[model samples]
Target: MELQQLRYVVAVAETNSFTRAAERCLVVQSALSHQVARLEQELGTRLFERTSRRVRLTPAGAAFLPAARQCLEAAERAAAEVAAAVGEVRGRLAVGLIPTVAAVDIPGALRAFRGRYPQVRIGLRVGPSDELTEQVREGTVDVAFLGLPATARPQGVVARELGRDPLVAVVAPGHPLAGEPVVELGRLAAEVFVDLPAGTAGRLQSDQAFAAAGLRREVAFEVTTADSLMARLVGEGLAVALLPSRYAPRLAGVTTVAVADAPERVEYAVWSRDGRTPAATAFLTAVGIDPEAGEARPAPPQEPPSV
Candidate 1:
């Protein structure tokens, strides 16, 4: 079967409407439908069940869909590789990161990457560290930025350590502990707190620290975004939160206290172990990382301009 036929089939399967699929494929409805029909006939089975009301994938279609997608991806990667050999980078860059990443300025990095490789399409996903790590391992994400407890490392992927910082206590300006220069985990445990969901990498750092100290803090609020909802909770004097020291300074309306015995969180940049796309490598370079060495590269010194 032709690659164009496979593309038509995939588009129809994803959109679930022949007309919409044709629009997406930049072809007329009849041409797209005819190609899909030809593909099905060649395979001697109907791929989709078509009714005037709705369109659904048949059993055969479901079985064929995944392999079809793989083929399309392989074809795209081959083309990208061919272009890369000539010192051209053109592909999609899928980036995933936790909300609290601090080692690199993500927006600025992306802006530089876009200026350098304008042909590459960029997509970003914000998620928890664990989920982003998994996406990197699964090849769905080209690269990811993660923050995990110092005791843990990203598994089954190529990773480079970005930085590490101790957790700090965030409290409202008028809260009792707000004025403290440094606080112990035990003391923070005695107060109500706002934190990330249990078992998430962000939450686990504080949880493990408290458990090690033989203390339990009541989490009055469990939120996903620390800079937004969790900060709001702490700012309103409802509860306190434990966040990475580097990130805490960015939160307004809250006071950050040093945690004398707080758990440390490590930030890492991870990518697939199998290989990296040229676009992914270009992005890592833009951020001053060496993808092959898994380490930060020294910035090039500026040269004096000729008069």
Candidate 2:
């Protein structure tokens, strides 16, 4: 009737004594005997024959013993499988990557991760930084690689720094400033700029830099896609834009020059506090970042200057 009753039946049959079965089951002998008796009564059959000298199983008890053992084994195996699933890092993990993040070797890392956790299914999504940040906040993606502004930290998210990508001036190979190690914003104000839209973090950082210098840049072309295409356009001498130095596409005719006193954008591995998963943690570990230790810390406050 009950699983414990079946276990009692199996233990008694194996030991040939209710006293030993009670010891094995960690219960009193009378309690074990009463449960077995209750089980037999519920089945309307005599499961055991009791004598003053020995306890023996009837033919019916012998027939039911095997099934009871099998049932207990099934229960044990089910519990083990569930425990393994929970204890081991094996499940579907969704990761988001911004197209402009070029420092992380995602393909190489993923190949290695697959080799280690073959059972973990990896799903990847590539997009701009804004969308990826939103995905991390919404719990649609387990983790994301984002190009966030220098001082920008998203709410309800934990971010680990992968690298710093400073905004740089990228020009055609034949351009005059192509070989310059660092160019001032005042000098670049006259150049035809291939810049991102007004609202993007990269564009805003550039705008702020020019504002600090009291300069205005002439936007010759505004690009929406911030990946290799911007580099290709710069390579063709269409227009020079301010782009992250790390993400400057590997184009033959493009040259990247760091902007003097430019604000550096940060690349972060972003994940929600509530949505962290074992698979996500494993992936973070694979990339050499400890998810537990990489909790985002508040920036230090600035000291007031003496007038």
Candidate 3:
């Protein structure tokens, strides 16, 4: 019946341990258990089957979990709204970033935001663009930076593009394609590639491009979203990699060439369509994004200078 009881139930469901949930809620184990027990009694159905080894949610508990989470979220949003009305920006802010986004100066933005709102706690999570977009949809991430296809947009999220990052082919200095200004993707069908893993925006784009050209891509090595590793692999002549032009200047021992007919990848500032916290809004502004205007500010063009 009470909000605290709802919170306790949700916490227990998430952690699956009364003691751990109590620790998370900053309360004693007995008190937390008593509150959940009271709620179960009033509802006249056992929510959880607790054993010494583990705690599992019952059928009734499974059905109630989603509504319980919604209630807690609503309460938190209400509190945030009231605090914002008084011009206070003190709360936790969750931010998501892709592993290879280089256009925005994230550290600089965080520095300025800290100077302005010292009380706001910041949590940063890095993942592939697809994973980050899912976190945004789940309400776990307040805002995110995502690299997406030119024609595809995530549903139910408000996205503001910061800029487009053109894809380029990177290879060692002595590689056969190193001297070329632009190389067709189909030409590399026989060459081994150092590619991003599946479920990433870059990988998705690469797959679609090769398929369209009727070329079966061969990846010699699969890597996470770390650009440095990809650069190192390509610089060593292990395999060629498709990367953003922003990396050309920094990656030594590598030549970056344009991929002929390759599609440009767009980076977006994505957030939930619902109300956002004032702190999140301020951070967005600090990062050079107008949250309300939703304007498209293109990044400066990157030409792979001879490096």
Candidate 4:
């Protein structure tokens, strides 16, 4: 019936508990219940059924939840668009970065963005590429930097190539293959591999590559962080891991090799594929480096070399 009423209903539908939804909505439990009752009365259907142990959405509530969310989101975006016109990109801009991208460029990119936009609140979250894509689709992030595969992309996400970060195999210094002059994925099929958890974009790519080569792969160990992966690779000599080339330069005493037949992992700028906003436009321009612009912009003058 009203925006507040819609919000109350949506919140209750999401949390499935009036008390919990009240906490999320920052209102008292009694007030939330009253509002939801009013909403149900208007809709001619009960949104939630209460029980001693738990709460569940009724059939009517399940059907109306998405529309409620859409209404709120559209109103929020509309207000944000108007705010953007005044030359201020004010609002919390949530950004999602894949682990590899976060490792290499997030700091630099954040520095650049913050220097230009001190007023805009910036929020950063890092995860694997697949998770990052899901966040973008859910509107959990305003922009994302991820290793999205070029084949199939998530719906409603506009991906612009930021750059390609090559994936290299990392081996411990004392390992048998560490000093090899030639490195190939085919040979490493039997060697243990340290992989990010399943469903990660990087792991997905790695798996697909192995599949293409007609090989079955196994993970010797799984690590969630780059540092942990590097430590495992360097200290145990237990398995070889593939990560962005940027991380390769930082891990000392590890043998990094280029995968000859593997596809180069690509990093891209992902945003809501709909609507234009100054913040989004400015961000895209700041990060976009055309891979084929034909003309190289003149470099900034460097200090003369020390005599």
Best model number under TM-score:
1
RMSD in angstroms between candidate 4 and the native structure over all alpha carbons: 5.4
TM per candidate: 0.92, 0.65, 0.86, 0.76
Lowest lDDT block of 10, candidate 1: 298-307
Expressed as tens digits, the lDDT of each residue in 1-307 for candidate 1 is: 9999999989989999999999999999999999999999999999999999878899999999988987887888898999999999997899999999987788999999999899998999999999998889878899999999988999999989988777888889998888778889878878998889999999998888888888878997888878777778899999988888778878878888888898999989899988999999999998889887778753334222111
lDDT of 2 by residue, 14-119 (tens): 8889999999999999999999999999989989999887888999998988888768755644554564577766656789986677557778779989998887
Of 2 and 4, the candidate ahead on TM-score is 4
Candidate lDDT scores, in order, read 0.88, 0.77, 0.83, 0.70
lDDT of 3 by residue, 1-307 (tens): 9999999998999899999999999999999999999999999999999998999899999999999988887787678778889988867789999877877878888999999999888999998888888888888899998887776776778888777667788889889988888888888777899888875777887788788788897888999865678788998889997776674556777887777777677888999887687878988888888888886455566665553
Stretches off by above 4 angstroms in model 1 are 297-307
Using TM-score as the measure, what is the rank order of every candidate, best first?
1, 3, 4, 2
Error of 2 at 266 (Å): 1.0
Report the lDDT tens digits of candidate 4 across residue range 28-97. Answer: 9999899889888988988788899888888888898888887886776677678787766655577777
Task: Look at candidate 4 and give me any clashing residue pairs.
Answer: none
Number of clashing pairs per prediction, in order: 0, 0, 0, 0
lDDT value for model 2:
0.77
TM-score of 2: 0.65
Q: What would the TM-score be for candidate 3 when compared with the true structure?
A: 0.86
**Winner of 1 and 2 under lDDT:** 1
